[model samples]
Target: MTKEMDVTEKIIELLHELEHCTDSEQKQKIEEMNEIVDGMDEEEFESFFTLKLFNKTDKMIEEEKISMESVFLLLKSVGQHKVLMHSQSYAFHSSSLNKRFEQMIIEEEKKKEERNEKLLIDLCECTVLLSNEISSELLSIIVTCLLKVALKKDENEETQKEVEIALLALSYIEICKSVKQEWYLNEIKEIIKYHQEHHNLTHLAYQSAWQFLMNRFHFNKSLDEVIENELHFSRDATKELEALIKCVDWKRGKGEEKRKKKNKEELFLFRWLQTLGIFFFHWRLRNEECVGLISSVVQVFRASKDDNREISDKCIFCMGCAAENRVVENEDLLKIGAVDLILEEMQGPTLDNYFLERHMKCLFEDFRRLKNAEDYKNEEVKRKATKRKVFDKMEEEGFEDCIIGLCHYICLGEFRYFSLFENYPEYFVYL
Candidate 1:
């Protein structure tokens, strides 16, 4: 009781001091108050927050007695405390405060006052910190405000920085149920489209935002639902993929040099392929639609061939996913010479990249299975016929000898087949 009383009394004194403190002193007082708050037990914290600190800070901000900086510091400190963050008092106060920040952001967008940038950033950070605690309604308001500032047609560096922060904040927050409105979905997608179309946005910031939108859209719902809910989602996804291909300089490093580190564009492209892989796996493109899309993916695979193994592998992985679509077949992919490209990569002299090899093999299997699906209408005979047809095709292409040689290499441990051991331990046991 004595300790709690001492802490509460000290916090009260600091709050009083804040009403009169200079700019420099404000940080010190807030930091001291945070330190005092940090020392309190849960019961003491609940008591202090409900009875004293919440009303005090709200009153101070209402009266304009404390600077925005002081409010941010206090809120930052409160957000850091687990008990305080989960409390009803904190949620109510944060929602109220966020509304003020949302309005200020709108006003500041028109004003473009450099001085207010830091405050805007702090407010966004607050949104990020308390994201899991706040209602989705409040979250959407702040997001709408941030997007308003971000989607401005002008190429202002300060605006870019603000949008970057907003993107980072979006990346941090989980998608809540309430924010699943169509406009919200479109707003998020617009960020991705904007980044693809505009050179003004920073690559790293917009990439994070793109990833956030893709992740939530793909993971949070069933594929059928995703396709049904969004307007022209399939067309938009295809366009986004094509736009990314154009954005990349596929000629970097002659397509043969091992990249010690991927640049921003490389990272972005890699992520693009990964998300699209997820997209393709769940959603099947129409037969008419498959041509252009598969052609684009095949182009990426061909361009990346012999250049970046990681990207080449992703390209193959994506194609493998695409191959699983009912409309996509050995013919569509082969018509684009995708099968031949995979065979070329597989037969490359430097086939030491395990993932690249594995992906190529998986794609071959996808092609084989898809082809067999077209050939064998009887379900009982399809499995047996598929194997015979695969061997027959291999023999016709003089790949039978190659398969024997690969088997020997696997038995001799000349290849990195740890994946095989983990996935099919019986094969290694037989070896």
Candidate 2:
């Protein structure tokens, strides 16, 4: 039988060579060390290191005898490698690693859906603690694996919050040290940005069970997407909201009641207008900036053929909202013909003009004209067949009002290729 001293001596030698070991050689040594160390008792494992050195070091730490540099190094050595992507134990002894232990975290988190977030919360705490204390190399592996778990759209909201908290903790810690500070800070920020942008992120956790699975999946598609909804609020829906969130704010203040009630729908239209002003003002040369502008700052860019069209879906909702709430008090906005423009766009094969006109009249605002409302109808018979049935009926039922609105809309708006508003003339917000 191999003596414990022999194993101890071998581990000590490999550990001592940590600084000079090449990657392949270091991996080989670690594998060998794992073979011996795997079965060792705590006492035997401790024997592998210099006892006097550990004792003196522990005593110094206990007695506050160590310098700051020493403490930091101690943290970097062990804590830094909090979790590796593939644990050597898991890689080597696949059987012992077992479905039981590996599935425990995932299964526990799965059951947490709609129940309680305890397990997911604990996972977050563990991940964050590791992030703060682990070695950079090991932390990278852990973070990448955890991100795969955390960013999954199917993941529970609790799990997402957990990830956010973990990133927040890392962000805070990175704000502390100098050596590992910048790298760590950037990593956490990127993760946060990814979650904010991605639709596929929560797929691992949420799957098909989430209510937001279809409608609210990923985040707001765009500013207009929500505005078109009579109910959903626009991200640029409010001054305060626009400054904070980057995604479309479709559900801003979703369940909240009014302080004094001044037509939530109309007020939301103002939010939409404010956003329009913003995007138009921010229009510039930078590509990303242009997208941000139309999506949040200016609404016109929604029509500007570009990428991220799904994101621009919010513009439809906002337009619908504005069309729904065409109040006389907002004549200045009406003069811009936002509703008229939106209605014209909706006149295609897929659009239900009758529904639009019905909703349009719900606003109680005076519409300017309908002289060109039919122009929006497509020439394709098959395309217009379904839409005409709905729109033509609307013309029959409320023909006078729809025509009035259309006329008012066209005459009211001071047509311009792009809005002249400086706040969001035609560009990205000054982010």
Candidate topping TM-score:
1
Residue 267 of model 1 has an lDDT of: 56
Clashes in each model (backbone N, CA, C under 3 Å)?
A: 3, 64
lDDT of 2 by residue, 1-431 (tens): 24645766766565555435555665565556565654454354444434343344345444554432333333222222222110111121122212222344455545634633444334333433333243343334334334444444445666665444333223222222222322233333344344445633332122111111112222323422222232122221233234433343444434665222222232333334433333332212222222222234234323321332322344444433333332212222333444344444434344344334433432222232121234235534533443344344445445445445444443444333112122221111110
User: Which segments of candidate 1 are over 4 A away from where they belong?
Assistant: 1-161, 168-183, 189-210, 223-264, 284-287, 325-327, 371-397, 409-431
User: Candidate 1: deviation at residue 285, Å?
Assistant: 5.1
lDDT of model 1, residue 373? 49
lDDT of 2: 0.35
Q: How does model 1 score by TM-score? A: 0.52
RMSD in angstroms between candidate 2 and the native structure over all alpha carbons: 22.9
If scored against the real structure, what TM-score would every candidate get?
Answer: 0.52, 0.23
Clashing pairs in 1: 255-306, 255-307, 256-307
Model 1 error, position 190 (Å): 6.1
lDDT of 1 at 191: 64
Best by lDDT: 1
What value of lDDT does candidate 1 attain over all alpha carbons? Answer: 0.59
